[model samples]
Target chain A: MNFDEIYSSKLALVEDALKKLMERHKECPPTLFKAMNYSLFAGGKRIRPVLLLSAHELVGGNVEESMALACGLEMIHTYSLIHDDLPAMDDDDLRRGMPTNHKVFGEGMAILAGDALLNLAYEVFLENAMKYPYKLERHVRAAFVIARAAGLHGMIGGQVADLEQEGKDVQPDMLYYIHTHKTGALIEAAVRAGAILEPIEGDVEDAVAKYGQKLGLAFQIVDDILDVTGDAASMGKNPSRDEARKKPLFQLCMAWGNRGVWHGT
Target chain B: MNFDEIYSSKLALVEDALKKLMERHKECPPTLFKAMNYSLFAGGKRIRPVLLLSAHELVGGNVEESMALACGLEMIHTYSLIHDDLPAMDDDDLRRGMPTNHKVFGEGMAILAGDALLNLAYEVFLENAMKYPYKLERHVRAAFVIARAAGLHGMIGGQVADLEQEGKDVQPDMLYYIHTHKTGALIEAAVRAGAILEPIEGDVEDAVAKYGQKLGLAFQIVDDILDVTGDAASMGKNPSRDEARKKPLFQLCMAWGNRGVWHGT
Candidate 1:
């Protein structure tokens, strides 16, 4: 498969599904909904959601069964991005060539938008899971894995470490820990959740998880690299943000050798 | 039962459960866990969790079955408190007689701790839900209700409105909307979820929900009243902060009628 074509196709599918899922309701506050839709629709590659879809498809699991999960994963990812860009955090102004959620909507509304998205993600998935009478176990298991991946031991913990380590990190283990738990955990969960939608063997799940881990690290390293090399117009956001923050990833890889050898390092 | 006595008893139970729940794993960053525990153990009245327990008991639901949910409700409540106290949000420095999460742990760690608590709340309830093979639907339904109560149309919407309406004139309806949504929705959900642990009639559920609405409204009105009238020593956090922000609540009622007639006003 042409990876770019597949990425585009899955991105379209997720974007369409997310639009439907996030359709404005009459009772919803107009501005709150607007803020949520603003960052949500401001596109990314939809890597997590597409991984969910592709995992389900690869395992010959019912692709339909994974749609809501796919959408839910993307919502979770987007919510994190919104919060991560807040003034208290990265203090970012631009995302995907658009104003960051907090920048456009004010800090308070952006926070609410992120909170709304997080809560709504569970609503979407749980509402979908309620329909599966026979395979409710699968649904529960998928939800469990995803929730764990998103919780204290996973994304949030890594985030805490990453923030604490900012401007002061010095260890290889800490870097690996932050990169893996912060980024890799949820990515692994995306693939694992999709594969477990049906039945699968232990070995297959392990292999998929390993693949996800490497891919997630690669994804983060590439992000760090792109932030240095890519221009604002093509990249949809400013470059050199990583260097300015003195973030650990690209700096460590450069310490090791060329960027191309980041993976082996 | 002496309501105060019962409140103490349930509060103890929830605090115990929450203490156990927040017992930090070695793997989790110590600072993040410390921040979470600081706010969590700072000790509120535990009204939401108590309400949950009472509702479950009142409905002849198994009291033991509702424990995780009660803890989860309180976790959600405490997480909201932590976020609301942030500099970008309410900017409060003290909570429950102690320095607020950010003041004690810095803004970034506090934010992540709040996020972790929120995610962990779902994990707690979902993990508990997976145990009841016979009544899995009840768990799903309860999760759905709780998620919606905390989402955009519920707490988050109210928060956005409350923040936007700050330092501005507003209508009575808007005040009611903000109070009911910001403070009332989760309170209402805590009860409704506990009540629905077993089957009940439409009228019964409606009655519980209506009771919750009134209680939640009254709860906020009382809080607003306390912020103005009560001493900081008794209330833990300093009073009159709401007045400083020009928040809409007790002022509206007092403007309309005497303080004693707050409920009808």
Candidate 2:
């Protein structure tokens, strides 16, 4: 299959898994679930989960085996988006042509919904990990990479720095850290996490992670470039929103596209 | 050692672990870490970690083996408090005579700090679990219990229900579900987590968990009773605060304590 066909098929697998898992948990409070589901099911490309499955496939792992984890990644992404849109954060009202979680449910329930989604992400990962004790070590490692990548050292760290640097002069290194970390870390981890599903050698793992990193960096730069070039109606988000905020997002892209996507020599 | 001495020693171990772990993450932003540490280091009895250690000991597990997980539990509890005291949540300013996380840091930072703590807790758990793969199936199980207990079906679930019921008539079943889930689930998980550290049988695990459930319920009742009867100067916060909120908190205690802590036969 071509890239679109392959991506769509993998995306279907992730969606099916997420739907079944969520449906199983009927006990989750209705209103809170509504808020969480609102964000979670809001249509997106599911790039992270698809990337994870592709990486898993690249390293000779089954999509079925990684289905729960793939869905879990989407949930974490959704939760981050929900929190990021809160009044204290980006304060956006519309997401993907729909009202954001906070907008529909109120900020309080939105926060709870994000919390629930995060907790459920781990639950999904752990539940999947529990089924395969013989490979418990790898599953634990995978979960760690995902959580750590989305964690303070990775996403949250970048967020803190960005929030701190708001309306201030941001240095190149700090700005680089913000985009690569805030956006790219988890993307890198998703690919690396998929690659590490099976027992791979150290050099191979390093190479795969490096590749993932380059891919992640490229993805972010393209995202920024899209913001400059893509139409608002199609992109669903306003074009040049980041540049409009007066941050030098394009410098990093120019630096990368001019030099190769990967940083190391 | 008496209970105090033993408790203090274990408490010291948890504190040291937490300190070392936090210190190891020096890369975390200063402001964000400051907010997290403000709440984490604020003086309160380390009851959760202590219970974990005691339970681990009761199940013949070494403290060193469980130290990381023990500290992880406290991190989760600390994160809960930070979020709980947010302006949108419980809105408490002073916790243990010091400013709450949001009171010290702005609301945005406090939220991030709580997110960081919760993420860190799982990271700590997985890091410790990674050290010994042979016992990982059980470690995965233990982590699942903690996550599940603190998750939407447990603590978060309870918190959501409580928030929804605010300024409304709270039925006894709803009240019971709130306390048992909001407070008791994690408390019970702490005990069960320690019990499973060494891989005990099903019946033993059940009995230990029962003991934990009883202990947790008793603790909450006594906490409510103390609010009605205890001195404010010693309690460090105002008594009857829950009552002042116009909730029949003590009534549940009176109904339970006057009868029995556990409702299930």
Specify the highest-DockQ model's number: 2
Model 2 spans with C-alpha error above 4 angstroms: A226-232, A238-250, A254-264, B226-233, B237-250, B254-264
Model 1 interface CAPRI class = medium
Task: Estimate, for each residue in A46-104, the C-alpha lDDT of model 2 and write its tens digit.
Answer: 98999888888988999888877788888888888888877777767777878778789
Q: Pick the candidate with the highest TM-score.
A: 2
Candidate 2, B218-240: lDDT as tens digits: 78777777676776567665454
Kindly give the stretch of ten consecutive residues in candidate 1 chain B with the minimal lDDT sum.
Answer: B256-265
Q: What 10-residue stretch in candidate 2 chain A is worst by lDDT? A: A238-247
- Let me know the DockQ for model 2: 0.75
Chain A TM-scores of each predicted structure, in the order given, are 0.89, 0.92
B11-104: candidate 1 lDDT, tens digit per residue: 8888887777677333688888778878877868888888888898998987679988888888888888888887777778778888888887
DockQ metric, candidate 1: 0.65
- Native interface contact recovery, model 2: 0.70
CAPRI rating of model 2: medium
**What shift in Å separates residue A202 of candidate 1 from its native position after superposition?**
2.5
Pairs with backbone N, CA or C atoms under 3 Å apart (clashes), candidate 1: none
Q: How close to the true structure is residue B89 of candidate 2, measured as C-alpha lDDT?
A: 77
